[model samples]
Target: MRTSSGAGELLVELNRDSGVPLHQQLESGIRTRIRAGLLRAETVMPSTRALAQNLGLSRGVVVEAYQQLVAEGYLVSRAGGKTQVADIAVVEPTIAAPAASGPPRIDFRYSRPDVSEFPRAAWLRSVRRVLNETPYRSLAYIDGRGTIELRTALSDYLNRVRGTAARPENMLICNGFAQGSRLLLQVLAAQGRTRLAVEDPSDNDLRDVAQAAGLEVVGVPMLETGIDVAALEQSGADVVLVTAAHQFPTGAVASAETRAALVAWATARDGLVIEDDYDAEYRYDREPIGAMQGLAPDRVAYAGTASKTLAPGLRLGWLILPSWLVEPMAQAKLMDDRGSPVFDQLAFADFVARGEFDRHLRRMRPRYRILRDTLVDRLAARIPELEPVGVSAGLHVMTWLPPDLGEDALREAALQRGLGVYGLAPYWVAGDGPAGLVFGYGSLRRKEVVEGIDLLADAIATIRG
Candidate 1:
């Protein structure tokens, strides 16, 4: 006899082919699990009727097994007529020794927001209001497309803020950008769309996602103005994913001509465009760029997340879909996780509608700008070899290194000195490209930024020697 589980907690297996009695087998299986600590002390045991129903045995067999276990002190009957594990003296597990570590390293990787800035008060207020006023039925299992309140609020907010003309019915709330992208890409792949084109040096996580969705990810070269439209057209890819508002790594906003051409390309080829408007909220110098989905709503899908604005642990994201893609995306979402937690969706909706979200962004924008400026200035002053690019907006800054300064060696040296620096080599998906480093300043203080740059400069000097 052995004990296992399937979906539920426990499964009891008994060999009827053996001459042993059924009740004895049942008793041995459960006893074996309890003694082995798989079923620990004080754990509630299943009722005899339920156990018998589950194991396809008579109530008498289950009752007999329970009685024997009770007699042996493996289980105890509580006042409420429930059976629970007795106090069995199990051997204590050994604890592992703690490993020593060095000083805390300053991390410059992108998207690490200063969680200290999260508006706990505002969030608590929204959540409290949701818990108090939202109907019990509304709190129950919701549609995969998300609640009407959140979608409506998002529709209004995106249109007013992101230049997107989204409708509530076409939106689906998801567990951040990763799951949203997976749901969309898997649906497209299932529809026989085989190729996904991304910028040559794009966020590699998107590549991993597309591949997992069974789509062939194609890499198109990225130009200063944005994605190379000509190369994208020639790549034989039916779908394209781009950070249109501000391209990652390069921070290149698509030129007006390129944006128009991309829409045309999608329209003419009947291909789809996936606009990753990930961190478009934190523009420092210029006004926020509008999303491409507005130009061709039917031909493009928009994905946005709270990961950048709020904490990533929230795992909150949304997708504004085209009318034609709504059904499939909703079905995908239902099959994926039914829907995201209603509490978050409800709270976020309240956050947006109450204007708390705007206030928080208003407060964070200047702080992030100051950090980005400090990073740029430090890199420019400390090491003239590093040329800061993509400083117009977002939480991070990218700096190009002179060809002679080997990126790999500098990063390794920096890591040795309690510094975390990211290089562009891993971002590139094709032919060799120029060397550069990406510094994420969102989570760092002005002092940390200054210190990190000095350390990077020292690493460069060491590599130069």
Candidate 2:
């Protein structure tokens, strides 16, 4: 253990033999103490004269260090010439950065759409049109349920595209699917719903959202097709959240029989089904599955977002709720940030109504499809032992790792090579799922996809020995 001299009342550590400057050492030592809360706010600090004399240092060195810290706002100098630790909030970090790797050069982690391909031109046009045509009073605190105009437009669009049964009166505009789910879950919890069932191996923040709304999160097993209805029934959950169209991470489209069973389950138990129609538009193999909300509108609350098709930065999403839950959901939303920004809602309303949203999706589907195909082909060529599961739809493919290859070892080795990829184990609700890696190619071009696979092979070779 290293020893430090106690200067005055404050014990600022310093090393004379170290190459670092005395003033710099003094500043850092004090700064660390302040941030660590040992030197708390309003605690008087020793004068530079006393500190320098006590540490056997020249007064000028202590003066320089204290002035620099004051300039940096870590210490406050008062009118009476008293220097004290400044009032600042600093969160202590819990995780350390990896020492063996540089920043990821080829990021393949999932959940984001290709931001480079976002329809900027059409979105700008829509915003300008809304600003010009819409009544100025519409910008005022209108309704907690969002502007009726946006809800109406989303209703028409989702109904036509996703086979959703939505109405403007029952729909609510949210900041994103996150806030929407939170609001709805709050409403559910208020109505005495205690438990929420989510599919195992889910990769999104839905479970966290449910828990925040005071509902116990239960994980039902996911089948090859979709969530296992039998397990969901046995999970003792009154509410369920599902990605009905295309399951995230694993691209499993729920079968017709499974869909029928889910509807039946909801009706029989008087349970609520929250349908997250995530990535419903980008189906490369066959027609995209329709929303399950059309079949059981009353039993299911359907949610859709502009996040995947447009951009996540927009923080725009909509929810189509049942008639009975609409009012309570609106009240919940009112309490939670007073119903998302009106300008964004109105602009998105105009975007959906103008057919530009449809145009954007049509263009992006092929681009993402090409990337998906490249990743699959490259993986097959480089790592044929790895089996690609659920590749028929969505922006990413979840590949099951071979029994011999551990996910954690491969992931770290891949990271050291500057290739970012996520293992499937963390997504498992109960830590009992097959080892896999989620390869998201939505943001990557075709050439990068090829190189990423090459890097993956090199990383695999490192851990294989």
Candidate 3:
């Protein structure tokens, strides 16, 4: 059999005194040799037992190292057949990054729901009703598509509030938008579409999710109006993901022309659109922008989450997809995690049916509106040099800084003054963007917003002077 393991010459050079773990060292050696073109495609590798004996190591250690490389696709094993180096063209799957090491010092990061505003009393009332009324058998492994009550409620809610044309049969309830996106990406990848074009200056977590499914993410430029369709046309992406309403961080509403252009492009290319209508409920500027899915229900996959309006802890998100994608996405959901909590889904359905959700949104909208107004006023009063972007809607604003005040220096200075802020640098694929900080006013008290800006002003002035 042809050999790929490079065990003949390289194993002799491994020193027992090396600080690295033996499994890791062995794993690295095999991968390096593959990349060096020393291991030809389909070259057979000895069994771990045989290689261990040849190298004077424990069989289990060699097995562990081989398994690691196999998991990463450096090696491939056919059932009841010899192991071999993976072809250069093979794609490897990746898992999500481990949770961030520790709690951020003071997180002013955007994308967080206002945890302070969760309607606990109403939710408890709804949960109590669901638990008491639900039949005992309803608790068994659910339909995987979601509870019937939720699917019905979601069907109505998306149409009434967000302008989506999806039916109960087309909706799938997952843990949240992250899980929904992952399942969709998995389906897309399974269909042989490897690259997804997503908006740059958007959420990194989405990019992480797509990449975790063994798909390449190409960054598409987003203009003040929306994603640059001209650039998107050039990208040759099979799927285009967009946040049309209230683009995150930069917060540009996709213009009507841009929105129409995207639909036409997708129609021409026979591609699909993933619409993340994130934070569509809290539009202070005008009537909410109707969902893009409404215009082309068969082509657009609409995703909405309660995380922005209610609470992230709820972990409730829904996807309204074209008819073709529904079952595949549902199966992927079952494989990922067997749907979200049934109790929460039932309670949320009750919340929506009772008009309590509308009441909650109505109450929170004005409260957040006041907070946003205060944030803008305070920043103007205290930090005259800083400019706020995308203040018309959503829960947060990006404060652009003058060139003399570098984002990193300003961020460190603010931390010293007991204020938390984030730089926009991490959000971009291309480096050194409009230097700014994202300020979230959702749960922040008026006094806190005022004081935070005061501290930020002092920090900026100190950095500049």
lDDT of 3: 0.83
How many steric overlaps does candidate 3 have? 0
- Which has the higher lDDT value, candidate number 1 or candidate number 2? 1
Instruction: Write model 2 residue lDDT over 1-465, tens digit each, in one string.
Output: 212223465677889999999999999998888787667677778888889888788999999999999999998888877777777723344578677656689989787788988778888988898888988788778687899989899999989989999999999888888889888988899899999998887864777778888999988877877899999988888999898778876777789999999999988888999999868888889876789999989999998888888889999988999999989988888887887887788888888898888888888888888888888899889988777877888888988888878888887888887889889888888778889899888888889899989999988887776
The Cα local distance difference test for each model comes to 0.87, 0.85, 0.83
- lDDT of predicted model 1: 0.87
Scored against the true structure, residue 372 in model 3 reaches a CA lDDT of 87
Off by over 4 Å in 2: 1-102
Superposed by TM-score, candidate 1 places the C-alpha of residue 229 at a distance from the truth, in angstroms, of: 0.7
lDDT of candidate 2 vs native?
0.85
Q: Best by lDDT, which number?
A: 1
Off by over 4 Å in 3: 1-107
Q: Provide the lowest-lDDT 10-residue window in model 2.
A: 1-10
- What digit string (tens of lDDT, one per residue) describes model 3 on residues 1-465? 455555533443456898888777788877877776667678777787788878788988788988898898888887776788889623344458876544434456666656877888998999999989989887889776798899999889779988889799889998888888888998998898878998878777778788888888888888999999999999989898998998877888999999899899889988899999888788887777899999898889999998888988888999998999988887888777887788889999999988888999998989889988888898888887677878788999887777787788987898887778888887775664677788877867778778888888888778768
> Residue 88 of model 3: what lDDT?
65
Q: Please, what's the RMSD in Å of model 1?
A: 6.0
